[model samples]
Target: MHQTPSRARSASHARPLPWRGLALAVGAAAALILAGQARAQDSGEVTKSHGYNFFGELKYPADYAHFDYVNPDAPKGGEIALAAQGTFDSLNPYSRKGRAAVLSSTIYESLMDGNAPADEYGSMYCVLCESLEYDEGKTYVIFHMRDDVTFSDGTPLTAHDVVFTHNLFLEQGLPSYAIAVKKRITNAEALDDYTVRFDFADDISRRSLIDQVGSTPVFSQKWFEETGARLDEPRLETSPGSGPYTIEDFEVNRRIVYARNPDYWGKDLPVNIGRHNFDRIRVEYFADETAAFEAFKAGEYTFREEGNSRLWATSYDFPAAQRGYVVKEELPDGAPPSNSGFVFNLGREALKDKRVREALALAYNFEWTNESLQYGLFDQRNSFIQGTPLEATGAPSAEEKAFMETLPVEVPDEVMNGEVRMAHTSDSARLNDRRNLRTAMKLLDEAGWTVGADGKRRNANGELLTIEIPVNSSGAAVLESVIETFVQNMQLMGVDAKMEKVDPSQYTNRERDRDYDILFDAYRVFLGVGTGLRQVFGSAEAEFSLFNPAGLASPLVDAIIDKALETSTQADQDTSLRVLDRALRNEFFIVPAWYKANHWVAYWDMYSHPEEIAPYDLGYLDYWWYDAEKAEQLRAAGALR
Candidate 1:
């Protein structure tokens, strides 16, 4: 998953390509010569490239037409109504402040569009850029400006605008993006009126160079100067963008309406030929997902990607669903599974011991949860990169063993012997497995916790063993059940564990501040490795309060992640990733959770989509179109009222 600021953050909103990991061998001279020849053919003064792939070669040719996942002749006229989980206060997505609207990215266009095919991995196609140019070394990237591009305000897009946007993100964006740019990108310069070049630091990898440059969205320099708006503050005014849509109307914290740009410059581009098919995209924000579901059932929204497994299994028995006015579809998922579960905050002294953490993890009964709550629609996610070749399985290869030898700490024998220790206990029949409970109790006793006469375990200081879990409203239903079961098993082992369902905003703020004992969280691991991964397990990120939610800090883990990112060959990447996965699993910072294999979605009968969806995304915003005739038919039948 190659994350771009212009891309959406979740599956339910405007779809963005995952900022996946990259792997490719480089051949310098021949690559530079070919790029120069291609560019020379396009323009006399400079060479240009249409796109780049992180893997070996580009699948689509130089003169390729529209993407295969779209209907070229799809008509666009009607509107599509969608639902958002929480309230949105800001329109400026670059800032780390308020939650931006769901489809906010639709208004902005990037130098390259990251809508890639299944096999391409981290490939990015030219969108705002007519062509791209870079040496095989990947020290710098040159974007050949499309002369015909213009913002919604009718201002011409130029190299200066690109430079300005890059600087804004570097100075005042999310700490993750800011830190990445400051370290990887050296400078951005305008070569001419129609060309911009992004110079990369020598330490940057080939994959990181392309992803960072191509995914950057160019903002109008003139608009910012005139408005005098702070880039770090949340503003009501929509930033002028050159994408297919613009803010038609908006009511703060309620609903946002976007109208397609009649003067959109890139509509006919090969990358966007059949995309952005809706005339209007309206995103309605609700306080909670339950209210949003009820609104969806009442036809307040036209489409929904269901996240609740229980609702998908038994809740859709309404008149619209029974009458076939609404449709339900299950699409295959190709991306990696989420590592969501009860994560221990290592900042707490009580959870600092590996034995205690391991004992707590063993008490969670995922098998029972899958059978009762989820309808057996999920599988346990064991590794960080679940459902991928990068995942560590079976035993460590000779390469992985060699890498582990260099580390200061010894790799666990169970991991080295290819024995995977699942978080669940052995007994599938009982919620509180007595065998697993005894094991947990023995481990706790060894870790200096003894059961008191009151049946509560306590340390030498008489401090009870307690774990606090803070959860948001969206996860309340799913987590409440899991928490109840986990607490039951923990009580048998003389441990006190409780979960508090907090408001959405309170939960987000507490998470950002890193103020909790145990929290239900999920982290997505991509296919490739890079410095961006530091946010999850790196010691430096722990200090910055970024993605290291568990407060994990280990020299061995850092070294493994660094080695994986630094490796160039496919074989080397495989070895380093496995070693890292094995090392992290041994730590037991998070009690692994279950993940669904497919996307469960329901939509109104008034919409249509392309036959093939992008492997990494649903492509609803990009490929799905509103059928006005169908909408009228449903309206006449009083099914859509």
Candidate 2:
């Protein structure tokens, strides 16, 4: 089973913004400039190189030995156990049918690696490909595969495999991938045994398109041909992949272990030099986070990344911690805070009115939640791209205002005046101030939801204003407490708000079907606001897909996204993004939630990591390695029972 490489395409769009101010200066009339460059490709001045970066210059040149952040001499020969919640039935991660094993991606490698240092602004280095070719316009790209690249089973990888992977995704994978790829890729053809060419559509951003295609995992064409298996099927036993590790052992729905491939083809690739250090990586599954945490404390799992703030603050006082057997640390989470919140389904007639949405937002008491519930460990997230330059700050820039004016209604004056804030009660008041609820009541009344004798808000026709927030069963405990607090606040304003916990599968289905009143999910901000935007807030997605869970179908939003995608300069991109952020905020599509400033990680102190972690990611797979001597020392110190 040759697997597709893990790409940033899945998580990049969820978070949109350039971190290092690397938005390239494509010059005046950027599209025309790119077109001119495309025409110049006939002159043969275009450079074919080993790698390319998204931003300015590549940090590492063609002859670079290894990444600067890795420890080249680090030795790895021990196992590292990690905890995973819920169960997995299939090893095929590409399929939408069942949950895939946690280590499925380790067995696959992509053509180019986008796991560059976080500050690199989404650059990628060649992995399986020996070198790549592209013109200045990036209208097309050619990947020259390494001659020695082969699957774990010794089957050679070729251009046909890459072509087959792309075609396979188009034919049988998720509709989102198919639709997106079809829109951007004009043609993907195998030019030779080890050479493939990809012609891109001119309408999309060339840089984003190239990054996406380059990061796609190349699969073995021969294996699929021999097995006659569809790419979308949930297969328990997958074909061998061309990566660092192979599935060593597994138990269905219990655990899985991956062993490093001693004869791995690209073990010495510069991109992989200090990465994938674990000799064996084992993952154990539990029913929920509580069980997973218990397993971590019991030493069943070697590491845990704590997501529950309560557990982080209150737990860890056990014998392991008292005996200095466990280590707890807060690592900086350098990425911009996600715009997480309760999203309204605009498809519901009652939620369509802007005033209604605003009224519901006012009912949320974030300050109280942070102080009393989260122990002040979280900060409120205001912008979709909060903490980034693209976030709409004190006011829209002059360029942003100019772009906003093109729409029928630019943002409200309050948005232009200063930083947009959600309704908050002073912490000292402990949610004592009823002013926010009064304001909510006023807004609801103005929106035709009047309080009746029954103490429920109702419209003229006597339909009560009801909001049902359905949460996933796995997160029921954590979210239920938050929802209870919010529902109480909404009830004070005579709104019939309630919370319901459902199975993860049911919740996913309902979200996809748009069957709930409001949803709790975060939209990933796009790094390079390209075709990915269409899947998120685009009008077409609003109609056909679940990406736009809010059912937000606005011509204004569509235009703004298009403008952002077209802008090539940092200034232009920033302005268009600010305008888009302002517009989204003005709609109150998402009732803002809170985000923690750091990652809460706890381990048994038997692993070694690079001195500096990637600003955006923990880099567990890329840099961290098992420490055998440290493990033995811990055992001697009674850290391990």
Candidate 3:
């Protein structure tokens, strides 16, 4: 399955302030003034900087079309390209799901961005909106846009664009659009050109507000009104946008060319002053990942970012590595790969019982699977969101302790009784699944689901336990095999469990529609904790129609989710999130899986990495310039590997 590389395209509107003091003068000036000269004269290669590096060949240049090297007037050019494994045609962030798609949407956007750190999973930074202001209760939020901000077309951006985008989230009836927008934002009114206020019927937080609002891409009022597009058919919608790069050219399943807008309004915004470095970004498409990789070896794309660990270790160093065209780079800061595991569809009817979920969690053997298919290339994880206040890190803060003690939310005996039952990524002391299975077995037995004569779990009604893992193989494949191994182990233990892989496109729909038992690798969440996990197991977000990926239902978990939303302070929010995490862990709702530290990447080295740690690869995109002379040197020496 040849795939097209993608980036996130948040459809929100935001603004940046005066950048005189931010030390962005050099970066901002470089992007605006010497962009062409920089691209034309870039040379030298340094492997490590802050925590991000890339050298993979671009397979799909059609969708991700580059015009910088060839012609600043022809199309925009980008340095990074992925050997996409499959054709996930959707590029719009609103419609896209997996990591590649989501990240690609960001690349194609001018709003929000994620940092590619030297040592972490990374966090998102705001681009368009200045700072989201949350009310004391967290229900209402105010977004203040910079007066000078303008769309890619050079039209001054206003609060109207922000309100318009949210309204579209409702009008288009985007799946998560309602959960993130409609439920809380009862009313949206632009105070003036620079300010927009959202009135929430209920309480929600501000940290979450910008993500919902600022993260969305803003459109030109003129373009939208002229197109008469209501987003009913996103495939056909071509509304104008205001970003560093505008769609100079785009073709479905072929290529997308973005040129740096000469008159880009927010070019010098405080948040985006140093980003969107490429003169243009060109993405070309291919049939499947295998062919795409072959093309990468042929220098068609950059190289490869093996999403599957087995392939990361095995597939590389093939005939291609013999040449100097490919090189495997180990991460100096953290593990070489990213987190991978199953996301139990809490929205499914089969996932309703907390014990059922815990019992299912025991079925997979992370240790065995790690040794078998993964070859110890990945780490396991119990928390849904990694590296955020929302993560269920052990040793609760003072506020969290009190919240857990008072809130009707019950912390399991494992959490409250002498032992803390903490979660660790790859604890040498204790294996990831070892502790998980113990809890799983205990939770199931306590829930009254007994092992049957046939060695399969049966409810009182005599129905055998079966888990339907919805799979399409869009991004990661580790979970599918993990689920299979788990099912086999469960059978040996007198339990009936099996892995069911389905179409990737239909998997989310089936899970979202509340139509599946257990969807293996349900989603690769977009942001760290910025994206509220309320819909997955949240009472309201548990519906198939809503944002509920996991169909878990519990009054206790729901209350904690609500309480978490009620606070506006980051410190208190962290405390609330911890309270919510411990409460859900006690319920045994989600069968925590594995976590990958970084994208296990192997690419042809060319471009120079940052001098220090670049906060994120995309965040510092503007700071990166291709070295033509060095690129030619590597090309001649075959040092690209």
Q: Which portions of model 1 miss their true places by more than 4 Å?
A: 1-8, 20-48, 117-119, 402-426, 474-476
TM value for model 3 = 0.71
Candidates in order, TM-scores: namely 0.91, 0.90, 0.71
- Candidate RMSDs in Å, in order, are 4.0, 4.7, 11.2
How many backbone clashes can be found in candidate 2? Answer: 16
Lowest lDDT 10-residue stretch of candidate 3: 12-21
Give the per-residue lDDT of model 1 (tens digit) for 411-465: 5677666755545545666677777788889999999999999999999999999
Ranking by lDDT: 1, 2, 3
Error of 1 at 462 (Å): 3.0
lDDT (Cα) of model 3: 0.49
Candidate 3 local lDDT, 228-291, one digit each (tens): 7555333434455666666666566555555677777655543443345566555555654456
